[model samples]
Target: MASGKEKPLHSLIAGSTAGAVEAFVTYPAEFVKTRSQFGGQKESPFTIIRSTLASKGITGLYSGCTALVVGNAVKAGVRFVSYDHFKSMLADQQGKVSAPRSLLAGLGAGVMEAVFAVTPSETIKTKLIDDAKRPNPQYRGLVHGTISIVRKEGIRGIYRGLFPVVMRQGANSSVRFTTYTTLKQFVQGNARPGQTIPSSVTFGIGAIAGLVTVYTTMPLDVIKTRMQSLEARQLYRNSFHCAYRIFTEEGLFRFWAGTTPRLARLVMSGGIVFTIYEKIIAVIGGRE
Candidate 1:
């Protein structure tokens, strides 16, 4: 059993394991989702999947899985660690965490993940996905792509959409954790003391939280994708610039371009990650 002092470490371990599982299961959906948000493409998720499979075979769906899996592991670990730390700091005299405090902790977690993990990972993943659709691809694979970006655009290139990514992630984690915690609390409040909530119920709650997250911050996500997918000094100057351009050129609805595939990926990934994470934490006798 993990003591209070070791709870944070357990969260890190469990979160990483959950992230790896989520990434592996949802990466194909992620590939198509990213492609759909690439600005000019109007293909439905099914059409994109069909064309990609026809042209690049089944392998195309997993174009950037390596970078994404590694990144998500680290991202989830840092997120849970930072969130737990922040939550403890924000707890009231009664040791209760309010919704606003939970939101703040999640915001902190998101910033940490964005700076340390998501930026580089998403940049590499987006580039690889874009390259896969090209006739003559520039980067060979993950390693080559990383090296190419560094050689051409330097370290900054790898963190292409840092600001928007931070914004999106900040809002994502804030809404997700806040909503999930609120829902979980509401469920527990109605249940008998010491009664366990089923894993299926927890998973359902997580899916709802993920849906809230996607809707609340999708515009920023679109801008982040657009900014990261381009060359270092390309069409869009910054997040605001990218948002302006997308709104003007593509119309308002374009901000949610990849909604279908994104919803599928997030709903399933969120449910699986949270359910597995909670189960692992329980097995380790750690505080949730």
Candidate 2:
């Protein structure tokens, strides 16, 4: 598949594989980071960890893992594959896709990833994890949460943070893909006719790009997290309703309430995701 002319399997394989590895490496941190977004009570990270372990066991640390995995797979796979496809198509017209082409490809990939990937899992996972506080309410598990949400909110209800997801992921992809391609070119220079670029180098560039995007989009990420969380239970009606309420009632600053946790998320899980994405590409014989 990586050999095929149109699909550009290398990119998809590399990106998706890297995403999987990254998810595994930083999953625990991710669990903590996500919970932090709930905020009102302000549970210390250590307390949160201890309590989670005591109540839910190590598995609670992986609350939304299935959602994260599926979401990342769609995101990385489409990003890599589509970036190549779009770039190559542009190349045919523009005498080789330039650095900016990579930028545009990144934008495209972001939108696509948001549409095809992030929205579904993000909303579902948040709802499942952030159930309205009840003394051990009805559903503590993902499956039960999902069923409850569907029965109560219906299909549209399941996808609360679509807007924020799209905005953040799109921005992230634009910066990441564009920077990755540009960095690769700058590093390569006018090397030998067909000399291969190093995988380590490629992934490093991706990491830098990803970090920038993640940090920049922090506000939106925080808002989305809250919208998807359980505290927002009595706060708003649904995702759209939640956003409107937060904007009007809480004010714009409310959107960024969980900035610290998000930053931690970016540095830990997000950074790992970018690095591992590169490693996965190398594992699958992918090229820059």
Candidate 3:
């Protein structure tokens, strides 16, 4: 069991492992969500899944899995490490953080991860998925796709939607961590300090957090996804333009086009990520 004292290295390792596992496990739903966002809101996930399977087989659902898996691992590592560091800094003498402090820490962590890991990775993943849908797909894999993007559009190509990504991630982590921390504290009431909650309880709390985060940030997510796609520049000028176009042309509900699959993915992702992270931390003798 963990001793409730977490180090940065422990957070990195545990978070990375948990993120990679979660990404791989829940990737199909992610694929569906992206396709739903890219194609149109009116198209149901079932129709997309059926069409993808019919046209490309099972592998069709995993077009950008490699990029996402790797990116999610690094992103999660950065998130956990930065969040822990910020939380520690903001913690009181007894090592307890208020909800407000936790939210701030999560925002900091989210921004860090967005700049370092998420932007490029998500850009590559979105591009790859977009490319695969083309009649003549260009890039082969993660390395080739990344190099091609950089060569064609320079480094900025891979950093598409940087602003929206940062915003989405910032809000995502802020809401998710704050919710998780507050709920975990509530659930652990009357328990001894540092006593690990049951796996089921942790999973439930994480799911709730993810649920809240998805709704709270779904618009930003939609905008980010659209902006990161290969043809975003041709379609829209900038992040503001993109948001305006989506709102004025596509309607307000368009901003939440891919909520279902995203919700499913996050629900499972939240449970799996927290459960695995805590388990790994416990085995490694670190917890917070």
Instruction: Report the lDDT tens digits of candidate 3 across residue range 98-217.
Output: 899999999999999999999999999999998888888999989999999999999999899999999999999999999988888777775788676899988998999999999999
Tell me the spans in candidate 1 whose CA falls farther than 4 Å from its real position: 1-6
- By TM-score, how accurate is candidate 2? 0.78
lDDT of 1 at 239: 79
lDDT of 1 by residue, 174-254 (tens): 999998878987888898887888999999999999899888888888888889885536788777888888899889999
Q: Where does model 3 exceed 4 Å of error? A: 1-3, 39-41, 192-195
lDDT of the candidates, in the order given: 0.87, 0.66, 0.89
Using lDDT, rank the candidates from best to worst: 3, 1, 2
Q: What lDDT tens digits, residue by residue, belong to model 2 across residues 44-156?
A: 66777898888878887787777677677777778667766766666644235576766777777778888887887778767656653334656666677777778888876
Which one wins on lDDT? 3
Q: TM-score for every candidate vs. truth?
A: 0.96, 0.78, 0.96
